[model samples]
Target: MFNGSPFPVDAFPQIIRNAIYEVEQHTQAPQALIAASALGVISLACQNRIDVCRLNNLRGPVSLFLLTLAESGERKSTVDKLLMEPLYQLEENLFEKYTHDLTVWRNDEAIFNIEKKSLMSKLKSEIRRNKDHLATNEKLKVLLASHPKSPVRFKQIFNDATPAAIKDYLCGYWRSVGIMSDEAGTIFNGYTLNELPFINKMWDGAMFPVERKSEPEKLIRDARMTLSLMVQPNIFKGYIKRKGDMAKGIGFFARCLICQPGSTQGNRQITSPVVSTEYLPIFHQRLMKIVNESIARNNENDRLCLRFTVEAEKRWIAFSNNVEYEMGILGRLSNFKDYASKMAENMARIAALLHHFNGDEGDISLLTVEAAVEISTWYVGEYVRLFSKPQEFTLAISEADELYWWINNYCIRLKASWITKNTVLQYGPNKFRNRSKANEVLNTLYSQNRILTEKKGKTVFIAIAGSIF
Candidate 1:
C-alpha cells in the first residue's frame, strides 16, 4: 500500500543499477533489493572524509540512517548478505594484516607498561625523599612520556553493537563507520539501556564524550556513524505502540529515511540463476575505488570539501523553496513536516554521493542536483503515503471510538436498542476486521458504561446506553 513508485535506481551509476537488477532477479524483492544497494553505496561514501554541499555556510555530511520495513519472507537478509559481502571481505583482510602488528605492539606495550611503572615509582620516591626533587622528577617524567602507545584494533563494520562500543570502535579505527543489521530488533531493544541520546548525537555530528574512570586523560570527539536497518512492519508497529510519542519527540525516528516496500510474497516464480555475471565484478570495482579513496584520505588526514556549482546551487535553492512551500501549506504535508524539512539536506547528501560515485571531482553538478531533487520528491511522497490518513478519519481516532460509532449508528438505523455479538461481527464496519478485535471493542464499550452486555446460552448481546427503539 506504499503509494509511490519504486526508487529510481536508473538515476545512479550503471553498476548500481545492474547490481540491483541482478539481486531483484534472484530475490524478487525490488524495494529491499534497491535499498540494500543504495545503503551499501552510502556506507562507502560515509567512510570517506567527504562533505556534500556548502550552502549558506552549512556543510552536510554524506551520511544517512536508513530503515526498511518488510515482512519476514521479504528476503531482507539475502539482500544484505549480497550487498555487504565486500565490507565483510575488507574487514577480514584488514584483520589479517593487523594481526602481526597487533602481536608486536602488545609485547612492546607490556614492556612499556613496566618501564612506565618503574619511572612513576622512581619519581614518587625521589619526590618523597627530597620534597624538592624537581630535577630527578623531570627525568622520570621524560622516561614515562617516551613509552610507546598501545595498538588499537581497526574495524569498518559493526553489527548489533551498543552505541558505546561503536563509539570506541570509531575512535580507534577510522573516525567514521557503518552499523548495519538485517534484524533491527537488536537496535530497538537497545533502548532499554537508554542509548537513544548516543545514537541521536552521533547522527547530528555532535561531539561524543567517552568517559572512563581508568583513563581519565583520553578524550574522544568528532566520531561519525551511519546506520542501515531492515525490520519487519509488525516489530516497528509494536515499537511505536510501546514508546508512543517518545519516539517522535526524541527525533530518533524522524532522522531516518524510512521505506515500507510492498510485499513480493507468494509471487515469486522459480527460475534458473544467472551463472556467470559481470555485475558483481563491476560493483566490487566501483565500491573498492571509493573504499581505496577513503582509506587514502584517512591515512593522509584529508577530507574532500565538495561545493555545488553555481547552477546546481540555484537548482537546490529552488528545490528547497518548493519543499518549504509544500510543507507550509495546511493539509498538504503537515503530517510529515519534520521529514519534509530534511528533504533538501538529504538530497544534498545524495547528490554528493552520486557526484562522487560518478567522478572524483569535489564539485556537485546541476544534473546531479536535479536527480537528487527528483528522488527526494519521491521519498516525500513515500513518507506522506506511509503516515497520511483519509480525510474522514485521523490516526488519533481510537479503535474503540470507531467501533462504538459504527455500532451506535447501526442500531439507530435499525431502530433497535440491542444487537447480538454475531450480528455486530457480521454487519459492523470493516474497521473491526475480525471477531477478536470486535470483541475487544465490545468489552471496552461495556467497561466504559456506554453499553450493556448480557450472556445467555453461550450467546452475547450488547445494547447502547440511553438509546430508544
Candidate 2:
C-alpha cells in the first residue's frame, strides 16, 4: 500500500551497504536486506558502552526495536544468521573464558567457606567461655564480605526466551542484550510472558524489579534490549485482530520501527554465493572491534557520550519543529500521532548509532543528523503504510466499486431509475457484512454524489446521480 520505495539503503554507511548487498544477492527481498543490516547495527549498539545523545537536557539511547513483515520462505532467518554469526562467535569465546574462570572461582570459594566456618566456630566457643570474641567475629565478617562470588556467563543474544528469563540474564550478566527472532509468533502468543511492560521499560532504560519469595532480597536492575522480529504479514494481522487496540493503546507498536517490504518471491533467480566476494570479513572485524572496545570501556564503568555540533543541533531542532507542526494538523497524521510524536527521539537515536558505526568519536556532524532525519522520514512513511489501516481503506473503496457496478447492471437492466435500500441490500454483491454495514456503504455513496437518496413512504431509495430513464 505504500507509494514509495523501501528504506533508503543507499544512505547507510559503506559497511552497511556492502552487508545489505551481500544479503540481497542471496535473498531477493529488499526488506530482508534492510532489516538484516539494521539488526546488525542494533546488535552492536546493545553493548551499552556508547554514550547517549544529549540535546538541551533531552537524552536518548541508541537502542531500537525493529519489526519486519514478510511471508514464510522470504529468507528472513537466513539473513539473520548471516549478520549475527560474528556475535555468536564472540559468545563462544566468552563462554570458554567464563568456564575457566568459574572453575578457579569455585576452588577459591570452597576454601573461603571452610575458613569462615572454622572462624565462626571459634568465635562461638570463645563467646561461651567468656573470652574475647569480638576480634574473631569481626574476622569472620570480613572473610564473608571478601569471598569471591560466582562468575556470571557473558551472553549478548537470545531467541524465544520468556520475559522473566531474560530479566534474570540481564540482571546477572551484561545489562544489555539483543533479541533476534525470525518467527515472532512465539513471543506474540506467549500468554505467561508479561512482555509489554518489560519491553517498554527496557526501551526507556527504566529499572525492572524481580522479587522472589524464596529469597529475602530483591533485585532491581536497569536493562537495555534491542529487538529484531521478522514475522509473516498474515500472522501479524492475526495478532492485531486478536489483540484489537491493545498494542497501539499501550504504545507498544508505536515505539517500534515497522516495515512491510514488497515481496520478490517468484522473481528471485538462483545466484552464486556472494558472501565470499563481499566485504563480510571486514564488516565482521569492525563489529568485533566495536564489541571489544565496548566491553573494555563498560568493564571500567566508563560511558562515551556524544552531543551534536552547533550546526547539527540547529538542524535537529528544525526537524523536531517541522514534525511537531505536521502532527498538529488535522488528518495529516491523526491516525499515527503516537508514532509521529516519537519520530524526533528515534531520529536522534539513529543519528547516534550512525555516528558510532562510522567510528566517529567526536560530536555528531550535521551530515549525520541530516541522514538520520531522511531515514526517519522513510520510517514514518512505512509506519503509516503498514499500520494506518490502508488495507481497510482499500477494502472500503472496493466495496464502493462493487455497489456502483451492481446499480448500473441490475437496476438499469430492469429499466428502473431508482432502487430501494431493501432491494439493493438483498441483491448487492455481498459487499457488506450486515445491514448496518450496507447502510454505511450507501450513505458513503450518497455523500460522494455517486448516488441520490430519496424518502418515500418511509422507504429510502437510491438512484444514479445522472441517470435518465
Candidate 3:
C-alpha cells in the first residue's frame, strides 16, 4: 500500500539527477576502458622504451589497431603487484582516511544544518511551482525551448526531481565516506549542499531548445517517471542538484567539451552542441559501464536502483540538453536531458579532485555526486559555448591518434539498442541486414518483444560493455 506520493513531485526531479551523481561517484565505461588500456599501453611504452614510437605513430586508426594488437601480461605475483598493487594500496589507504570524514555526513547535526541552508529552501519552492507544469504530459522540447527561463528553471526541475529518501540515503553514504575539509566544510566545493538548480546551470552552460518528434506527451511522462525512479530510495543518495564552488575550479583541466568535426565548433557552455549521432551512444555507453560497476561495488545490496538507471537514460534522451552538433549545422539537436546530463558528468570530475584531498569516504562520495553534477553541467555548457566560440579546443593530434581516441573513448562502449541491432559479428555480413539475425541478438538480450524479460537477461549492456565489474 505504501507509495511515494507524500513526497513533493518537485523533489522528484533531483532523483532523476542521481544517475549523474552516481556517474560522478564512479567512472564512465569508455573512460575506464581507455584508461586501463592506456595504462597498459603506457606501461609497455615505458617498459620497452617505445614512448616516442607509440606517440608518433598514434593516429586515431593506428591507435585503435594497436589496441587490438596489444599483448596482455601473464598473472605474475610480482607483475601484478608491480602494476595493480600500488594502485590498490593507494585506494585502501585513501579509503581508510575517507571513513573518518564520513562522520560529518552521518551525524544528525550536520545533516540538519545542511538541510537548513538557503539553497534547500529555494529548491523546495521551485519544486512546488513547477509540479503541475511537468504533470501536463507536455513534451519538454516545446516547453523548455519556448520558456524564457528554460535554462535555469529546467535545472531546478532536475535538481528537485529526486525522491527525499534516496537523497537522504546518498547523503548517508557520503557521511560514510567521510571526506570533507575544514575550510570547505564538506568535500563538495560549490554544490550548495542544499542548493538546487542555480549551481547546476552556472558552471555548466544553459539549457538549449529543441523540437521533439516522438509521441510528445508520452515521452514527457516517461521522462518524468524515469527521473522520479532514478532518485527513489534504492538508488543514489537522493538528487543532488548543485555542484557549488568545487565544480568551478576545474574548468581548465580538459581538451574540449564539444569537439565536433565541423559546423558547430569550440567549447563554450551550451546545451548539447551538435555532434555525430553515431558517437553519442558510444559515449553514453562508456559512461554507463562505469556507473554500473560502481553501483555493483558500492551499494550494500545487490539491486541497482531503478530510478538511477532510468535517470541515466533520460539524460541521454533529452533533445536539446544532452547532445552536441558535429559536422552539420542544420537540424535540431537530439534529446535535451541526455545531452545536458553528459555535460554535467564532465563538470563533476573537477569536484572529485577537491574531495580526493579530504581523505573521507563519505565526503568523497558526496563530492563524487557533486562532481557528476558538474560534468553534466559542463557537457551542457560546452554545448552552448560552441556557437560563439567555434574552434575552441585547438589541440593538435595525428589523424590516427584521433581515430583511436574516438574508438577507444566512445565506440566500444555504446549504450543504445542499435549497437546490438547493427553489429556484423553476430551473424556475419548479413547480421544487421537480416531482420532475423538482428532480432536473434535482440532476443538474447531482451525478451523477444515481451513487455518484460528475465532480470538476468537485462545485462545493462551499456555498463557491461565497458565495466571491470
Q: In order, how many clashes per candidate?
A: 0, 1, 109
Best candidate, TM-score: 2
The true-versus-predicted C-alpha distance at residue 425 of model 1, in Å, is 42
Ranking by TM-score: 2, 1, 3
Report the Cα lDDT for candidate 3.
0.26
lDDT of 3 by residue, 112-137 (tens): 44544444455456577875444333
lDDT of 2 by residue, 1-469 (tens): 4364667777767776677776676666665345544554554554386646666766556778888887787777777777777878888898999999999999999999899889988988999999989899889889989989888788777777777778777767577788777777776666412468778777777777776678555454555678778878887888888774777877777778888877777888876544444566666777778888777665565556678999998998898877775553222354578887778877888888777776776899998898888788887877866664433587777788788778878776998888877887687767553677887676556545688665557676778889742
| Candidate 1, run of 10 with poorest lDDT | 325-334
Model 2: residues >4 Å from true position, as ranges?
1-4, 36-40, 43-47, 129-146, 191-193, 214-222, 271-278, 390-469
Q: Return the lDDT, model 3, position 214.
A: 61
Per-residue alpha-carbon lDDT of candidate 1 for residues 124-160, written as tens digits (9 for 90 to 100): 8876787667766776678767766655566767777
Model 3 vs. true fold: TM: 0.16
Those runs of model 1 whose alpha carbons end farther than 4 Å from true positions after fitting are 1-3, 112-146, 191-193, 212-220, 360-362, 390-469
- lDDT values for all models: 0.70, 0.73, 0.26
TM-score of 2: 0.76
TM-score of each: 0.74, 0.76, 0.16
